[model samples]
Target: MNAIQFITQNTQLDSKSVANTVSLLEEDCTVPFIARYRKERTGNLDELQIGAIVKFKEAFVALEKRKATILKAIEEQDALTPELKSKIEQTVDTTVLEDIYLPFKKSRKTKAEKARKNGLEPLAKIIMAQRTTDLEFTAGKYANANVPDEAAALEGARHIIAEWINERTDIRNQIRTQLEKYAQLETKVIGTKKDDEKAQKYQDYYDWNESLSRCPSHRLLAILRAESEGFIRVKISIDDDRALDSIDRKVIKSNNACADQIAMAVEDAYKRLLLPSLSNEILKQAKEKADEAAIAVFTKNLRQLLLAPPLGEKRILAIDPGFRTGCKLVCLDANGNLLHNETIYPHPPQKQLREASKKIASLVDAYKIEAIAIGNGTASRETENLVKNTPFKRDLEVFVVSEAGASIYSASKIARDEFPNYDVTVRGAVSIGRRLADPLAELVKIDAKSIGVGQYQHDVDQTKLKTALDTVVESCVNSVGVNVNTASESLLSYVSGIGPKLAENIVNHRAENGAFTSREAIKKVPRLGGKAFEQAAGFLRIRDAENPLDDSAVHPESYGIVKQMAKDQGIPLTKIVRNTAVLKNIDLKKYQTETIGLPTLQDILEELEKPGLDRREKAKAFTFDQNIRTIDDLRSGQLLPGIVNNITNFGCFVDVGIKESGLIHVSNLSDSYVSDVNSIVSLHQQVIVKVLEVDIKRKRIQLMLHKG
Candidate 1:
């Protein structure tokens, strides 16, 4: 098959653009680099389309490698005919190629091999021809010392015929298609473990049966996970008689003395060989489709979470709440540097409310804390209540931040290196504050899987998951340009071409020589060369740079054109950079060159109007309803405010200020049909939901979005 043509038809892009993208990918150009810098060459494809092309191109290369292996194996067997070789060379689908190679595959001693050794090949060929008469006489002629009876000879012939039918590409493909369209996935809970406490989680799947094609991705993954954990047995199949008939009709062409023997062989093949392999292939296809859907959801969630609005630099107080251990409190300066940390127990078991209130007020006044960020964990609501009741020197914006990965980050190596003198508690409190300040910068430090925003993250293919998540991070980081002087190594590591080692170098250089005054100064760092600078400079912003455009998205290569625009407009570069009035009057068409199209020039014009502007909105305060602080306090049909905490294929989990977060199934996301949960709700989106069901024993709550 022509891979490039297939890609063009699948991705709906021009063949020239797909070919150019494939060539660039072969040269080791990163997707972000190509999408951002090579728009003129790619027909201006975005990262999503470019990423698809890269994946399919790699698939085509893998297909070719598998074909070579199959061809060599067949040739070594000395049965490779010109016609067979030609067919194998032209086939593209992996399954079809495997089917064509099946008869030649080396295998353990089988019934067919033993039957052939006993001189049953002629009888088997006569039965397959369906033109034979006196089949019993033929079977008797094949009998020898190994096969001494007519019955034994007939049975051996049937085995040989079954093997031949099992390898036919036409018959296998037809059965495979039937299975794909009609198969049902079934699960049976382990009998002895039905009452086991550990197995109780899968009780709902004890006798579950669903059409494999119609099964939702989340439910399928959940069942597979349960099976992998050894609490259930799962299988995919259809009606046994129907499946047998499909192969029987395809293998037996006519009714004759050989017809009955042929029918027996077809049944044996369907039962002993073809059905098992075909069932597995059908389920494998279903699993791959489910993984794609789950990964897409995870990709979208990670994108939204990484780009969540940052509170920006501010003096803040952060709390990681607990009851017996007290709340781990820390004060952070405008840049999120840890200033002070301590523990306070204002909740029960200590109930030192008066003293804790006075201490909190004093810290707020002493540190000039402008906002309060409390982790939404144990005692989080109580802590917020206490903080809101206190009379501070300045009004504070209180935010109940999701602390999903804060503990993981606290114990991480990056946290230890950043705060060698502190404990894990202090690092965790600091993380809570920093993420509230800038989610993108703080989040990149932790593993994306631990963030708790994915559906079946641990169950999905880890390599593919990591690659996709890394792409999301890179896209978000470049989409919102990084601050060179203040960015952490983890953040800078995601900037177009710079990786962890180079990020460390940039941070060390800044510490030794001072802030980067111009984007060009980045080149002075060890090992950061022209190519790296070319790929990374536009995405790395330097605030208050010597050259104003250095802090914007306009690449350094286009600096000359921007300068000419300023010159033609008869205004100083500094004055014209942010002066929308002057930028609006200039003709973007005047700057278009052969290498630069109108797309690039137009992007440059937008950058000129908003130099170094952040794409995310400013973070706002969110509150949960006070009356519903605990699960026991919840009631059916009651309206309560919530924030979407985690999303999956089945539904979204919203935190309503309780230990158990409520689930809004995709069916309940809208009054209209909601195919994608993201279209109606997003990570951290605030809305009101009505309680549908509350199961105290299961610690689960069902919720529906409140329309009004």
Candidate 2:
């Protein structure tokens, strides 16, 4: 099949649609752009589908190029027979192609080649065929040419056949498949030459053994890490009986001397060559699976973290908690604009407690602050206590926000643009406050992986983790439209079509040209282009604009249709919005087209019902017990309310008023099968868990979801 046809078939898109997307992508049109602007041509494939088609097309082209190169390489060696050439050409998978080209491929000196050069091919063939032949006669045949002893002759013949078995592509493939299905991975810890006290965290992995397929990603990664640090050795072994039986049935039959030699040769080939290569391949595959699982967990956490409810355009005073350096406080207006900044010495030594309180009261009075956001970092609890007890107006509420990546954003370029004259600490306080205003918009400024949400996040594959988290961020940002006029460049970058550069351009254009009055003004931004506008416009809101639809998520392309519907209903667009009576009468089926599907239509209808409405609710304020500050305070059978920090393949980590979170293993996640922890719990969700076990020495806390 042609590239477009192949992509369409694999991805379940129309052939014509795939072709058009591929052409646009090839011409450097971005995914968001094509999905938005070229909807008519591409049948309105989403950015995700267009991206899949682009990736598939590239992979197909790469495979074709690799096939041609392999064909040429084989022909250049003059070992390309019609049968072999045809087999190679027919091979589509890279692994199978490499397997077919194995024999013809150049290699280092091998025992079989050496033995053949020494005139032992005849003896080797007899051994391979497993013919009923006397050993003395075989020895004589080999010795006649070199005048070697019986042992050396047998060795030479065995070496020749061993290499022959190793060179057979079919045999290797068969063995690899069998080993992958049946092999048991064995891990042993390296006994310390020194004291064993220094490396106890790896103690459990040192003697672990499990089937590769059944082993979880975290455990596998742990074992690999132990092995890498010279604290353990890992090996894969198949059941000897099954392995021998398969080889005997496939390669050897009669119990002759030749048969015995062939069996020995095959065993040697597997032990000395094939097994090691196959084990490495299995390990590589295992690592890939582990990385994917870790990335999935991280992605889920990031999504939850980003989608956490916003405080809804309220004025907030953010305090970045500190001790010796004092606290950095910044006040942000309703639209996240910085209004004031100050440093408060709320803690010891400089203990200007009254002055700190007075400064906070004045700032709150000046900005009409509706809430107080205190960063959950060093001295966070102290700050919270101060805010709670201080005699401020009873109308103001206090929240302790997880300022995980606030520092990272404070030093970012977006922060620089927003507060050019402010110090990083001051910027950090502003970020903390803005996050309370809108979590998704502010969090997108910092890297998702660095949000301190997942377990063992640093130990996972960084690149794969980053890509997955980035995808989740993009999906979340686009899923909830951003305020085009108020969104920072970092937030804008996560929009469907707009990326880092385009986001920067948008921000730059805004700074130079002032606030955008309508979504149409975005197209005038340099380098934004039509495609970028198409993907981003629907998700960007221009509140109180000339066109009421611009404030809603109704795509500019669908404006005429929405207006017509509004006119036919004999109501203003505003009345139709969020009015169930007006919305129920509208027939969505009549609007069906090749470009717009049920999913997009339903989404548009929902947006029309609640134009520019934030779907997330205000998060309830929760505080863990100060007395139970660490795992030491957690007792077995004790039930405690905790927030789910992360959900991984193996378990969920819940922070139950402790420094170290407890793990609720997958088996104990629920009574029924809990195949995925994400299905059971999510990040920042409050859950009551019972402490199942606590290993104080190991600092491990095992928790159960079944609370009594």
Best by lDDT: 1
Q: Give the per-residue Cα lDDT of candidate 1 at 197.
A: 89
Candidate 1 lowest-lDDT run of ten: 1-10
How many pairs collide in each candidate, listed in order? 0, 3
Per-residue lDDT of candidate 1, residues 407-501 (tens digit) = 99999999999999999999999999998999999999999999989989988888889988998999999999999999999999999889999
RMSD of 2: 3.6
In order, candidate lDDTs are 0.89, 0.79
After the best TM-score superposition of candidate 2, give how far the Cα of residue 240 lies from its true spot, in angstroms: 3.1
Q: Please report how far candidate 1 places residue 543 from its true position, in Å.
A: 0.8
Candidate 1's C-alpha runs over 4 A off are none
lDDT of 2 at 694: 96
* Candidate 2 residue lDDT tens string, 1-708: 578767877899888888888888877666655664567678878867976886688778887898788889888988778998777666656678776766666354777667777777787777777764678666776675554776777777888777777677777777778777887889776665224665677777767778888888888877777777677898887776666566667888788888888888888877777778777877788888887777767777888988987887899999998889999988888898888887999898788778888888888888899999988777776777777767776488787787788878888887887788989999899888888888998888887766887756776788767766777787788777888888888888888778889998988899899989988888899998887787688889897898888887778988877777789899877677788778877888777777765656776788788787777878667776665756678789888888887777888888765557799999998889988888888888888888899999878999999645
* Pairs that collide, model 2: 33-531, 189-206, 190-231
